[model samples]
Structure formats: structure tokens, C-alpha cells
Target: MEKLLVIGLDSVPPDLLFGKLLDSLPNTKRLYRDGTHGTLETCHPPITVPAWMVMMTGKNPGALGIYGFRHRRGSSYTDGYIVDSRHVSEPTVWEILGERGLKSCVIGLPPSYPPKAINGCLVTCMITPGPEKEFTFPQSLKNEVRRVVGEYAFDVTFRVEERDSLKRELFEMTKKRFKLASHLAREKDWNLFILHEIGFDRLHHAFWKFFDPDHPKYVVGNKYERIAEEYYGLFDELLGDLLEAAGADVPVLLLSDHGSKAMKGAFCINQWLEREGFLKLARPPLGVTEFEKAEVDWTRTMAWGWGGYYARIFLNIKGRERGGIVPPEDVPALKSELKRRILQLRDVSGRPMKNSVFEPDELYGVARGDKPDLMVYFDDLNWRSAGTVGHESLYLSENDTGPDDSVHSMNGIFLYHDPNNHQNQIKSMNAEEVAPTILNLFGLPIPDGMKGRAVKLS
Candidate 1:
């Protein structure tokens, strides 16, 4: 079997690749010309954590029991925990490959903290505590990584409010990621190699404001206007180096968990819930507050929400929550009403903001752990969902976390290159199809329970 190489670029957009930055990204352009490429539809609420897992495990978030980075462990909102790879119940493609005695090198995929043992090396990503912690499989590779590259960056420091410092930090981190990935590609012999870079995601989040002049926060003549474009150019150069190391005969798969778009603003969902009488706070907040710390009156609160790139609501139901109020019989009616009200929500200009609201039962069609009653998108991905309740009005000035410019979009990029085939092959794909497709490339059976079918590349 030809060796399979998977390069995961978290949150890479097609517009930038094929449209905006194509001329300068020569390697990527050549990949596009030489192989099959298309938009890979991502999992809903397409953030890093669950989307990449979907690509690896070939399962939906509901089946995996991982909705996002932070998931509710119990019925209470306070019971939420930062999701890690340990939380994943399904075996990843690498784990399955390992069972088949195939050597695999996996690096820097999200929620990969506390690296799991693999047939080959492992480098944890995103929530890796720090360089001081154990971030590699053999434990000794962490030191070697640091020795080769001064500091192995799991993620860029993304507090966009600190623009000047963030630019310098992001560049340094991008270079370090490329350096480490190049070293690892040549350091070991493996049947499959996987490496995910978070720099594209971080760059889009931080500098999307400067790149898109029409963004509400975009500044004219900003020094960082072309930062994202330039980074794409640098990434192309890195791709050339890495491909040189991987050699000519290997089949390459380039993928991103999700795409990114300009964020208009944040919609404070908790505040909206309070206004709608579904949620109640014990006292007026003095300053910026989080839902878990807001001291809510659960006895009176029938429903409340927590926020992220999207909004997630929990029904305060009897027999479920600590101070349950909404009875079992009343559940459906309440959900309907909640959905109706959410649809009625509007932006500051009074234009309808919400794109759609989802119920896990309707979407996933089965019971899942710690499922949210409703999932929401606003203004078709231009707005973020804010979880706080202290705001004087429905809207907040900016993201409470930081000055974020980009929001996640459901469409990500996928490019497949086969050394033997030159024609345009499969044109479009889903995030789940990737794992099954790779398994098929190795002449392995697609797991019967997987939600996707392998694409025919011959």
C-alpha cells in the first residue's frame, strides 16, 4: 500500500485558498491542479474540538458524545468540563490503524492533550497544559521537540485585543509549528503520518478584521491588513518543505475542521433568556459575569443557555436538573416556545439574527449524553453567542473573551492527491467520510457503524 499522509489545517477557508491567496500559494495551487479538491461539509456548531474528532472517528458529535470544547458533564451548567481526547469514546483512525499494526505519527490535533499511546509517536494539541507538561507519547520526545524548536506551541496566544503582541506571537508560533512538523516527518518511519496546524485558525480569528475591509471592526490602512495572506504564502512554502520530506509516491490528504468568516458581534443569549422570563438571576451583576458564576434562581428558571461560537440551551426539567421546574409533560411545548422566541430574536438594527435552532433529538435521531435542548446560529455565522447575563441590553460591545474578528463557518477545505490518478475525482465530502476513506486506501474495511462511506478515488 502507498503510505497515507494527512495534513490537517484547522479552519482553512476555500475562498482564501482558491480565490484570494491562490496566486502566492504555489504549492497549494499545484495540489489543486494535480488532484481532487472540494469543500468538506463540517459538523454543526463547527468548532475545533468536535469537528476534528468527527473527521478522525467517522462519527457525528452526538454519537461521539462530544459537542464542543466545553461539554456539560451532568444536568447542571456548573458541571461543564473542558473536553479532551480522553472524553472520546470512539476509536480514532490512528487507534484503529494501530490495531492493524500500522505505524502512525499523530501530531497537534485539538483536544489531544494527555496524549494517548499509539503505534508511533503522539504530540498533543490545543489544551496541552504547557511546554512544561508531558506533551509527547514516549515522554522523551517532548525534550527533543523543545531542543529542535525552542518552544513547541500547541496554540497561538489569541487574545486579539492585544494586537501588536499577538501578531509577533502568532508569527513565531507558526514558524515553530512548521519547524517541528518538518522534523517529525523525517524522524520516524510510519505507514501513516498526521499533523494538524492551528496557526491558520488563530490567524483568521485575530486578523480577519484587517483582511476584510467591510468588517464592522476593520480599520483602514492597518499594518496587519495582509497578515493572513502573507501567512498563507509562508504556509505554502512549509508545505513544499514537508512534501519534499514525505517524498513523491505518498498519497496526501489536506483537510480543515471548519472554515472562518467575519464576526459582526456577540449575541448575549443568557441576557435574552432573562428578558424572555425563562431564566432569572439571583441578583444584578456588578460587572462581567459568567453563567456558572451568576447565581441563577434555578427554582424559577425553566430554561437557560451557555454560549460559544454557537448557543446551547438546557431545559430546566424535573427529574433531570437539581431544581427542576419544567415538568416532563410540558417539555415539548417549552422547547417549541423557546425555538419560536429564539427565531424572533433580532440584531441591533432590528434585522432577524438567528439562522436556525436545532434540537439534538431531531438532528441526531437518538439519545446522546449531556445533550443541549437547543443549538443556535446567529446571522448565518456572522455573530457569536455570548453566555453572560449582566449586559444592560441584548447586545454587547464586543466578545467578552477578547477582540475576536472571525467566527466559524460550516464549510472547510478538503484536497486529496493520488500519485496514480490525474483526473478530477470525488468533488465534495463530509467530515466523517475522511476516516473511512483513509481506511479504504489501506485496504481496510470501513467500520459498519461509521456514518460515512469512503470516496472512490480510482
Candidate 2:
């Protein structure tokens, strides 16, 4: 009852549990045979930061005050603030446990930028920098996060190689991360031990063609499927290693924040903005021509942008506080107008959703006060929106007919094991049931904030 181990694998969709190539995944299937299981419902919009935070604080994003990435946009530059404990209004699971004289170990969970004060070990993830020296966790555990990410943890840039060595490096890192977590579990005698794997999320982003049969990126002429094969195969081995490492005396759980797909087609938010009078343009954008910059009006335009699983269109009311069109009195009308306009477009495939955007309320059933103003789900569920005002990839060039060709689904995979039997049984589950069950398992108080029910462990 004093020891619980949680392994977080990002972007693992629940449907991958069948007899297909992924279903044949030996260790995952073995895990099902050995454990009592169900889906862990991720946070609304199912993005990584929000979902994990929900698990940590046991509060909704609205209540927690981390509404999808950061503070609201300012017109020109829209870099989001990294989520931190200052923004968390309620006590987290770690804090609650610590109050009860129990210690916990937390590592590499996103938006841990400011680094919360936790018992035992505190290795922060998604932490930003002016100095790495500022947030190093006891030097020893900091070394572990580095062991998985190397120098790239601080500055993640693109690599030119295909799924060759880079993919192998990721798998090796996944192996080490879990191994390190297992080592920590043996080392710490506490109520909760958590390790979130960044591999699955990266795999979904970089190797979608292999798992997604519908991707335009996939080709019969290439080795894409091999990417999925090798990635999952290695993960299966790692899960087995984790199971063996834990030695079957404690509850071991596997879960993901969200699932993914490579989406094509970008709905130019600026395009929509200009059309709706929410945005103004400098000159000619992607498809426009014969425009003179001097003749175009800039004072009247707003900004529009997108990203995987999300989008935003807002007025340029940042500094013009005295006389801005989106004034305090107009905020209500503007939000409604933005929501109405986004729902009008469709993806290239003609699905009503590809071009639609849902506000936070629509996505999570949470109140408007706690959610982002707009949540857009692409057509085919594979189409994505751009987060930047003007992106080059939104429009198809003469040679490119496909949309962005990159996407991800917040829907993901979950696995749970019994402490008594090593490998006994398994099943499917919806994502919403995850939080309540874990709190129930830890014997922690479940807040009224959660909409999910605890899965029965007995």
C-alpha cells in the first residue's frame, strides 16, 4: 500500500490493443494478461501539459489556471508562459502525500518550469532556461533526465536524418528512462513514484506513417512500417524489462496523455480572420496577389494562428487599451463571433469537423471561464491548423497537393497490472476513467473537480 509505480507513455491511442501488428506487441499483450486494466482519461483537449497537470493537481485546467499553454496572446509575439506551481491553486498529489508524511519522486512531467518543492526526489521536465544551474535536482536525479535526453533537453532542434539512428537513439533513451525509473522505485520507499516517457509522443510526431494507415506520408515504396515495428517492438521489450525490474509485488501502471496522427491542411487563421474582420493583412498573403503594402490598412487587422489539436483568433487589443475595438465591453461579443466563424470551414475531405474549432467548453464540458476560447478539430481528424499567423505550408504549392501531412490524436493507450498476478488479463477503456481510479488506488482524496470515475481495482 505504500508503493505505487506509474509509467507515462505519451500519445498511445487505446485502439492499438488488438491483434494487428501493434496488437501482436508481445509485452503489452503480456501486460494485459497479467493486470486489471482500463483507459486513463486525459485532460480536455488532451494536450500533454494540461493532461499531466490534471493528474498531478487533481484539478481541471480551469480550476488549475493553466488554460492550454500560457497567458493570453498579445498581438505581435505570442510565446506562452511555461506552466508552473504558481499557477496551480490547489495542492498537488505530491504535496498532499507529503503532508501525510509520505514522500514522492516526480520526473520529466511537462510545464514543471518553476520546479515544485516535492519530497524525496524532484527532477523537473519541460523546464525552460536562462540557467540550467537554477533548477538542477540534487545533481543526481538531474543526471538521469540528461541521460535520457543528452544536450538536446535544453534546446530541441530538428535532425536531418530519417528514422535511422535517431529512432534507435529514442528507443535507447526510452529503455534508459524506464530503467532509471525502476531503479528509483527500488531506491525510494514512498506513496507515489512517477516517470513520464517522452518517447511515445516524439514517436507519434516523427514516425506517424508507420502506425497511421491513412497517412499520405506513407508509401508502399518505403520502410515506414518498419519504423512503427521497431519502435513498438523496442517499447514492448522495455515494458517487459520494467515488469521484471519491479518484481511483481507492487501495482505497475502504463498510460499516455494523448494519441496522434499526421494532419495535412492548415486553415489559415489569418485567412479566416481577414474574412471575418477579426484580422487585417499587410499585403498579399499565401494565395493573394497584386497587393501594395502601402495601400493596405494594417491598423484594422487582427492575428490568426494554429498548432496540433488547437487554434486561436484574437483582436489586436493588447496596447491600445484606451480605444481598442476589442475593448472590455466587447470581449463577450468577440469570443462568440470567433467561435461562430471557425465552425464554418471544412477540410479537403469535406468532413464537417476538419474545419471546425470548439471552445474549451465544447471540448471538455468545462465552463468558458476555464477553457481556451477556441478548440478546432480538423477534418478526417488528420487535418491540423497552424499556430502562426501566416504559415507557408497551409497552401498547397504547385507540386504539393497534400495538406501539412502531420497530425496527432489526443486519444491514447492505457495498461494496468495486478500486484498479485504478473500476467493474467486485460481489456479496453475510454480515456475519461483514468484519474479517479488512480486517486482511489493511492488512497488519496478525489476532488469534486474531476468528471471521471475510479476504475475498480478489486
Candidate 3:
């Protein structure tokens, strides 16, 4: 049986990996040239939390019962909770393999904070509050991780004003993560190993405008114009070293949860709702205020939205929300009206923005948990949805919460390198296919409930 190594690079777009940065990434480039690589279609609301979980569990967001990182708690207006490992009830690939007596080493898979016990070692993901808490499975592994990398970094604060300092922390965090990964690969006894790095996503979110000339905010000949290349080169070098540590013949799978691209701007969804009479406020905000902080008259409001890479709109329907107003039978008509108006919205320059709206049932047949009544992608994801209110205009040139240079896209990336069989081919695959593909590589049967089929690599 062949050992499997899965490297998850969060928010890596195919164009950059296979185009601009290809030559600079010798390790990734070689894999792409010799392996089967292509675009991996991400799940709806393509945020990291659910996408990575979706890939690992072979379950849709609905099945997983997680919509985004933060979910509204039982339709409470202000109450919400961040998703963590406790929320994931589905059996992951590692858990499934463990049942069959195969050991695995897993690291940094999101919503994995308060790390759960596995067949092998496990280091929780970005959601971890800090290293002081028990972030490793079996508890003893925490000491080993500290001995290897001093203090483990769960994530970085990317939405800061200081670019130089942010850049330094980003690279340092990645180096430490890879160093830990390399050390564990050599020391741990495991048939399967998985490592996820969030640095690439942070790089894109913070420095995209500096590197990509086509970005709306980009200026030619900027100081950080070459930052993307430098980061990609460093990533490739670390990847090469980690592969060496893993073994020469291990089958490697490289993928990302979702892709990243230049963010045009943020559309204040709640402000728009207020303007359209869907959301009502007792009084106008004095200045910019988060939706939760604003004085909302929920009794009069029809719908409200939460912001992220995409917009999640919830209707204040009768007998549903605490302050329900819209009648249950009137939901379809209201949703239709809202969708029509949203699609007709224009950009700042008065051009028709290409927006898409989806109901939970439309995207996932069996919608579950605290799902939004409407899922919206402003300008097909070019424009991020801003949940904050009190902005003068419906459009803003930056993210409402903080500084963000990029937004999530539907297509990420996938690369499979098999040393034994080099049947190089490029083909698109869905996020659900990854779990089954891993099972197939180890000659294990994919569970009947999995939504995807195994990809034939040989």
C-alpha cells in the first residue's frame, strides 16, 4: 500500500499556481507538469471553514450543518457562535481510515480547534484561540509541537494597516508551520499525513492589490509588486523540503479550499436593505456601525444580511424569528422580489453588476441548521458583501470590517502526483471528490453516503 500525503494550501487560484507563479514554484510546477492537475470546484458560500470540511468529509455544507464560520444562534438577532471541531459530526477521511487501522497525522484543518482525538496525531486549525489551550490530540503532542516550533501559530491577523509588519508575520508564520510539518512527517509513524497552510490566503488578502496590476486599487511599480513571487518561491522551497521529509515515493495530493482574486469593493448589504425598506432602524446611526450594534426595529424589518466573501440574508418571517414579521406564505414572493432587485443593482460607476442569488434549497437540496434565506454573491464575487450599516452610500472602495485586497472565488486548485504512474492529465473535479480519491489511493472502500466518486489516477 502506498502512503498518502495531502497538502492543503488555502485560497490558491489555478491561474496563479499554473500561470504567473508556475516557473517560480519548482516543486509545485514539477507536480503540475507530471501529475493530474486542474480546477477544483468549491462548494457554495466558498469560505474556508465549510469548504475544507466539505473536502475532508465528502459532505455538502448542508449535510455538515455549517454554513459559514459564524452562524446565527437559533435565529437570535445578535447571538452567534464561531464554528469549531465540536460542530463537525461527520466522519472525516482520517477518522474513516483510522477505523480500518490506518494511522494519520493531521494539522491545521479549520474548525479543528480544541482538537479531537484521531488514529494518529492532530494539531488543530486557525480557529484555535491560542497555543496555551490544548490544541493537540492526545495532549502530549503539544509538547512535541512546542519543542519543534517553540509556539504554534493558529492564524495571523491580516486586516491591519501596517503592510511591512503584516508581511513579516505572514512569512514567519508559514515558515514555522512548514518546519513543524516537516519535523512531524519524519518523526511520526503514519500511513496518511495532512497539512493545511493559511499563509497563502493571508498573502492574497493583504497584498493582492500590490502584486496584481489588474487590481482596481493597484498602482504600477509599487514597493510590494514582487511580493507574490517571493512568497510563492518560499512556499515552493518549503514544499520541496517537506516532500523530502515525507518520503520519495509517497503519493501527494495538493489542493486549496477556494480561490482568491482582486476584490473590486464591498457592497453594504444591510445599508441597501435599509434603503429598499426591507430593513428598518429606529434611528439613523451617527456613524459607521456593525449590523449587530445598530438600533434595529426587527418588528418592521423584512430581511437583513450578514457579510463576508458572500452575503447571507435572513428573513424575519412569522413564527420563525423572535421578532417575526413577514408571513410564512409571503416568503417566496418576498425572496423573488429581493432577488430581482439585487440582480438589478448597479456598481458605483453605474454599470450593471453581475450578481447571483440563491436560496438554501437551490444550492443544497437538504438545507439544514441555521441557513440563510438567501445566499448572494455580489457581482459574481468580485464585490464582497458588507454587513455593516451607516455608510453614506451603498458602495465602498474597501472592506467594511477591515482592509481586504481579495475575495473568494468558486474555483480553487488540485494536483495529484503519483511517482509510480505519471499519467499526466488535467481535469476539473469537485471538492467532494477529494475524500473518495484519498480512500481509493489507499485501496479502501469509499463510504456509500459520500457524494462523490473516486478519480482514476492510473
Candidate 3 per-residue lDDT over residues 1-458, each given as its tens digit: 55899999999999999988898888988888889999999999899989999999999998888899999998899899999999999999999999999999999999888889899999999988898899998799999999999977888999988999889888989999999999999999999999999999999999999999999989998899999999989999999999999999988999999999999999999999989999999999989998999999988999999999999999998998998999999999999999999999999999999999999887888888888899999998999999988888899999998899999999999999987778689888899998898898899998998979998765
What lDDT tens digits, residue by residue, belong to model 1 across residues 119-164? 9999999798898888999788888898989877777778657788
lDDT of 3: 0.92
Q: List the residue pairs that clash in candidate 3.
A: none
Better of 1 and 3 by lDDT: 3
lDDT of 1: 0.85
Best by lDDT: 3
> Model 1: how large is the Cα RMSD against the reference?
1.5
lDDT of each: 0.85, 0.59, 0.92
lDDT of 1 at 136: 93
As a whole number from 0 to 100, the lDDT of residue 6 in candidate 3 is 95
lDDT, model 1, position 323: 87
1-458: candidate 2 lDDT, tens digit per residue: 56667777767766654335556588777567666665555665567767777766656665565656655533333334556645666666667678878877776677665666677776656445623554445556666556644542421211224556656667666766666666766665666777777776677666666556776656765665666667777778777776666566767777777766565555554455656666566555554322221223445644344444555444445454222445556666776777666566655455565355555555545543333455556564455544444345333211122223345565666767766656444455444455566677778777676666676654
Higher-ranked by TM-score: 1 or 2: 1
